[model samples]
Target chain A: MTDDREKRRLDNTIMEGLRSMPEVDPPKGFSARVMENLEPKRPSAWTRFRLWLTEPRSVTFTPVRMIPVFAAAMVLLVLGFYAMDTNDSGNGMRMSTIRFVLNDSGMNARTVAVIGSFNSWQAHDAAMRFDDATGAWVLEAQLPPGDHEYMFLVDGQKLMADPLAQMTRDDGFGNRNSIVFVNGTYEQAL
Target chain B: MALLAFFLLSASCAWAGDAGFVKMADRARECGVSSGMIGQIESFTAEGSLSDAEAVSLLLPLVAACADNFPLASFEDKLAEGFAKQVGPFSIVRALDRKLDEFRFARDMLQDSGGGVAQQALVVLGEGLSKGVPRQDFKTYVSMYGDHAPELFLTGLEMMSLLSQAGFDFRLTRSMLDVGFAGKGLSPEWRYFVRIVLVARQRGLTDDAIAEAAGTVLEDSGSLADVAVHLGFTSRDLSGRGLSN
Candidate 1:
């Protein structure tokens, strides 16, 4: 009991000595600076974007589920190559199908051929077949897109223009040649 | 050594009657004709449309054209057409002579305007000039693109020729073409402008009305489809279909 009393008296004496010390002032804005340091910091837009891009994630796809995606990619690749080939092969010329029809009222032509600038006015492979139902001569040909002047050659000798042609030009050979325009689609001249 | 070998081969080909085309091809090659053109000649002569003497007659101008580095396809195509038509060799030669004159005129005109031009440009210009497209109308473009981009002149000349063939006034045709030329990314549509006009004509629109419609579209820097729409026509109407009488 005498030791406990002595320890209490020493504690009271030290407390009294601390209470006797003078107070010291802190630097200006010290508390505000401490508060600012405690606040949460926000990253910049570029920093966030970089983090998002660099963040690792798992992409799970079963072989069955990916089959269609792979097929579509292959198709697109093939189509792109095909388009490139077409443009390169033709030197920018696109082909279109044109139907040439000649109405022979009573000429009873043995053979009819469409001849024009497209084929250099040649008629060998341009012969039209007779349609029994319509009694008109028709031939379909693949031509590059442009304006072409053509005429009907009957019996391998007589040349004449299409009666239903929208426009006719002087052939400079004392004859009229019908003009037909093709633009990468099926065109017909009646 | 190669020249002697060529001469020997040429002699052998000349001796063989069936090998007449080979002889002509050697001569063409000797005269600097392009191999592609030589092949074209071979295929044409193989058709047996011309006698050896007639083929020889046709060779002189062809060689002359080759030596001059002129557009030989035009002459070759004419020869093919003549054979297909079964015309007499003399008539074919006459036609070729006239064509040569036209080509010469076109070349001279282009040379006078600027300098050397693309062969295709010369050919289309020849056709246009012969068909009565005003030469004066082409001066602007010829001076602008004669050397670097003569194909532009070719395109312009072709458009003007088609318009002339369709019987449109030159002033109106040139004006419309000017509008098309000024617009960006409109060259493809210009290629089909004549087709649009043809469709309009088929729809019973008068030439004046057609001009007005084309003018409005051009003024707005519109496309060929726009011109069709302005005429109250659709792609279905413009797309070709069979019509039975």
Candidate 2:
């Protein structure tokens, strides 16, 4: 018992000495270094119990049974991601998936491309593909959030606006260009 | 990465192949279409008096000829509306052209005015245009909402459209707005008051009395609904029914 008391006294003295030492700011990257080296902490008993309480699992969930829940989770996830992708427009930077389609511009067309402000108005670039299912020439692109002016280049010669566009703008030269608004709502979580 | 790839893979199969679709000619370049919209279009063409080519020609230009980022879904919906009404292709196209023009005009106004709730305001603007609200009156509301979000602008236009639908002239609608939105931006209570005023007008209430009631609704501490009930439309006792009673 006497030896244990001496040891405690010595430890207290050492702790006092350490506490008396001057304080200083940690070196740059100190936090990063510490975090890199840190081990994952185990949860407390109460926390583990709370987690168990929250995570309710049905004992009857066979592989088939789990499929519906899994599918529902996936749908929610996709919708959530899509909503985020379409809505977020922070700091003037926006990203969105825009699908462009042209039904029937002309009977004799060799190539069709969507040229827009997003692609520096390149006529040949952003080529639309003839969709088999819908039978409409389609081009899907990721464009920034805003109003984009564009036109379809048909057969590498004719340029025309989207006939389905609800709004039209005079493109300086007698013709009009279709304007697309990309409201980036589906942002990637990563 | 694995989860994302899995999701993409699943979605790919979802836009799967279906029969009766006229597969794109090998030379044709189109993609991103998985819906059987073409078959439906073909079926629609079959139902109408026009030939397949003629129907397609009319339908195809609906989206293509439009300028600006018009919602294709909305265009399709309007097309459906026309079809439902049994309107002819030429008339439908003309109507669509007019609708697109209205959307452009409203879009330009919203952009120039600089406000939130633009979509709702655009709807209200369309209604106002249909009611023949003067260009100058639109300017008044546009300026009234200077640097403010479009909530009140939408509300104001909605009020105007209601008054117009009630057979009150554009001048009366403008006068009511001049009174209701006289203060700093709009209050939610103001809309309730507008409804109350509409009911009053329907009951043959004079303009002067309605304006006084509007002033009372704003100045008094009682809620707009309370004043609205005080006016009429509510199942209130007949004592407060000042004019038409």
Candidate 3:
């Protein structure tokens, strides 16, 4: 019994010794060191010019040198087409359908409603209906868009944003909205 | 263009050899042996005798072929030469055989005493057989049994060549020391003579040249201990060397 007890104590001591070894950590300012090493060095003007002049057989023409000529020709062509196609009638704004798709996969409820800057943040004015067959909640409203932010409310409890929609700035209360850009271009998410 | 051709040829040859090695590995695995064991057997067949160059060549490929099987970092040629000089080829085999015997005896004794010792002995024997013996010999031993003992014995000799190259002191223990005389009823003087033979073999000294070197070391140095010490060996092992003819 005494011998067994002594052996147990020795085993515990060895285990403790092994456990006491310190964990290894990466060196300090590791990210900054990596960034500093990876930063591109600027080449001399002569070296840059030599690199630009050497053309591979695959791309025989230099696109960088011809950009200005291409842009001037495109502007002249577009102006000529516009001069031939214009008609003088004020048919500008119309009440067209602006589709709202609740693309949040986390929304578990049967219905979702949009409340944001466009709808004066009103929940009752624009309630979205769930299409059970398509497995999606959608809303269609008439609105002229420059930029907007919106939030999705599901089952009167959970709040989320549409993952497939456009970007928006953060509201002070930790919520965000989907934005729409009208000129066929949207600002990318930051 | 020549360089490119050479590179292409070498690459193709390497690919073919890799495919061959894989086939050998599969056959070995099917036969319940490790690839290292298969390689060791192949090495022995390639070089019939345990000459220094033969040993060096065998060890190089065995290590390269089965790096995963052994705990060795790398075999050094100079070290092997040093060991070959210290312990003759015969003595090296005798030493390893002695170790295996002792391990077997220990295992038997443990079984007689209690089941625990037997279990421990078996574990030790298994580990020693796997790690200490060359993989090819071990595999051949397992697959072929009695018929393969001669080849396994030669494989053991090959191992001595490797150990000599690696600079291991085969006379480090009683079991290791008695290997050369375990079955051979060699007298003390004859054992000493065998030591000289081993040293000569290590120096690539032929049998006819032994008398001349033996006389010079004994006469010029008064004691074999002094000579062995001069040769970078511990003085205790000099007792294996025989005195004047």
Candidate 4:
């Protein structure tokens, strides 16, 4: 009980000393300095750009001064067109894809292939797949741009002509070979 | 001295075969024959499709063609075609001989018609000659139209062959080419004369009818596409079924 009384006396003495202190005014512009410190730092580049854009500026107009700019534009346009043309020519050098189709609806052929100058006339090099929907044998080949002579070999024994060939030529071997002109059209004669 | 002479003679003979082979290789390079062509022939021998003697016979004419500066591709292509067709070795040799003759005839014609002919042009003209275009007709066409651009010349020759094969009269064929080469009526796209003729034939237009329509429209500086339209040919007739077909 005596220790509790001593603690209460010390607390009262400190409280009385704090209550006896007098009120005083702060230094001049102290609150203003604090407010200034609280304000944001330097503006960003985007803000400066927006401020510059909103500000007015004068622009001059003269045809003679634009001549160099116009010439540069023309040069750029020409280079662009030249690049486009070069790309087109590169594509032109590529081999054209030609589809060879043989309509063997009634023959019920077990095998069919395309023999032509493009493949050195190999019998089985360009075998055609039988499409059930169309009932035909079909093959596609990449051939250079030129005239190629071809024929359909049916079932490894019979040499058949393309029934819908655009042009047929004498194979000089007593058989007619289909001639397909593979040009820009990518069209197969048959 | 006697021993030295024998060694020198032996060395000369030893190098002779290799020198001949090197010379032949040089000629093949000049004539556009790939060295692999020999490899193909040797492969044939290995495959037993050609005897040693028969292979030599096939190679002799190719070398002769090279020595004469003839285009070897036709011979090469024919040889490959014959082998691919499984025609015997002798048959391939005979075909090569025949092709050599065809190329000779073509070279002679090109020479007779004012020589300065390119190898590709010679090949195209040879194809025309072989397809049965008359020598006189080819000479006239080449003399008249061959001096222009190489592609145009080649196209003209190809058209001559195809049209003649299709039974178009020489004079009418000549006239169409004249209009195409005139450069006033037809577009510069006349470089594709072969394609135009192909589409024309595919449309089933008669030779006389095409000639008539071309004579009327093209002579008056009309467009190439117009000649087909003048003959009542539609875009559908000109168009193909393409890959879907």
Best by DockQ: 4
Tens-digit per-residue lDDT, B1-245, candidate 4:
33543443344345434554445445545666776777776677688876555565556567768877877777777777666566665555555665666778778877776757579778876666655567777778877875677666776677677767656689888787787677545443333344455567666866777787876776777654666578776534444333224
Cα RMSD, each candidate? 19.0, 25.8, 47.5, 10.5
lDDT of 2: 0.55
Ranking by lDDT: 4, 1, 2, 3
Off by over 4 Å in 4: A1-94, A123-125, A185-190, B1-32, B146-152, B183-204, B220-223, B240-244
Off by over 4 Å in 3: A1-93, A103-106, A183-190, B1-245
DockQ metric, candidate 4? 0.14
DockQ of each: 0.09, 0.01, 0.00, 0.14
Q: List the candidate 2 regions with Cα displacement exceeding 4 Å.
A: A1-190, B1-40, B57-67, B71-74, B114-117, B130-133, B182-185, B189-198, B220-224, B232-245
2 against 3, candidate with superior TM-score? 2
Q: Give the clashing pairs for model 1.
A: none
- Evaluated with TM-score, which candidate comes out highest? 4
What's the chain B TM-score of candidate 1? 0.70
Local error of candidate 1 at A61, Å?
13
Instruction: List runs of model 1 lying over 4 Å from the truth.
Output: A1-73, A76-92, A119-124, A184-190, B1-25, B29-54, B132-154, B182-186, B202-206, B240-245
TM-score of chain A of 4: 0.48
Error of model 1, residue A49, in angstroms:
60
The TM-scores of all predictions, comma-separated, are 0.64, 0.41, 0.21, 0.66
Candidate 2 lDDT, B61-88, residue by residue in tens = 2434233554444444445534433456
